[model samples]
Target: MNVRPAEPMFVSVPPRPQRLLHSEAYIKYIEGLQADSKYISNWDKQLRANTENTPVPDQSRLPTHWLGNGAGNHGSVVNALWMLRDFMMKDALGINKTI
Candidate 1:
């Protein structure tokens, strides 16, 4: 009796080319928007407000674990499954924590 190697079960197809909206004119239009004084002033005001208004929370005062009635407790199974999928995908792709 002779044994044969298993054949491939699926064929790989090349991905379709992506059409990006980064033409020269579009880039120039974006650059013009960035250079506009009103846009610059709005962004500057937003940045200043964001930096000045918000205060960082004290991490030491935060809860160490999820509460029994919290959203995490309700979706614990879903979260565990998602974590498993992510771990498997990372292991398969050889990705590190930094990635």
Candidate 2:
């Protein structure tokens, strides 16, 4: 499903403005993102609107859970989301190949 981003949500591969190797820039960026920031609220509103008639989704999983760290706690989730954003940007940044 296509979910519009709440923000630009760009995570540049290798980060355009270089910072410490520790990558505090990545950490700070995702720290501000939330499940609601990824159009999850839109999905939720649609679901609520359908509840009165349509059968809401069953046995379904939404990708937005990762935004809220549904799989684990803070650090791991942060890394996962950060990496995902970086991967999505790879092609546009001419980083299609990985070693």
Candidate 3:
């Protein structure tokens, strides 16, 4: 009887529900935000200040949570979406590397 070596097998892995949010659509959304005039202005200001060695704001003394008119709540939703997008991109890179 001859013994044969086992061949490596590739398995298709499905993304979790949360990770499904990270897709091309999400990347486009982020790009859209970057394209907004207000967002660009704010980002440019921050970058310029950082390059000029401006003192950092004292965020350590700020309140962790503030009760506001639904703005904060909406911010949380946006944050979750971004998180999902990041997760999905990372997962994609990992899959690409394995292949």
Leading candidate by TM-score: 3
Q: What lDDT tens digits, residue by residue, belong to model 2 across residues 1-99?
A: 999768866866784786656456577655756865864234555334422454424324334575654435535543455456556555554755553
10 residues in a row with least lDDT, candidate 3: 62-71
Candidate that scores best on lDDT: 1
Q: Write the per-residue lDDT of candidate 1 for residues 1-99, one digit (tens) a residue.
A: 989998999979989998876876578666767544665334444334432364435544434343344335436533443444456655865766547
TM-score for each model: 0.23, 0.22, 0.26
Candidate 3 accuracy as TM-score: 0.26
Model 2 ranges with Cα > 4 A deviation: 1-75, 95-99
* Residue 42, candidate 1: alpha-carbon lDDT: 49
lDDT of 3 by residue, 22-47 (tens): 66657866676754366533445433
Angstrom error at residue 35, model 3: 24
Position 67, candidate 1: lDDT: 39
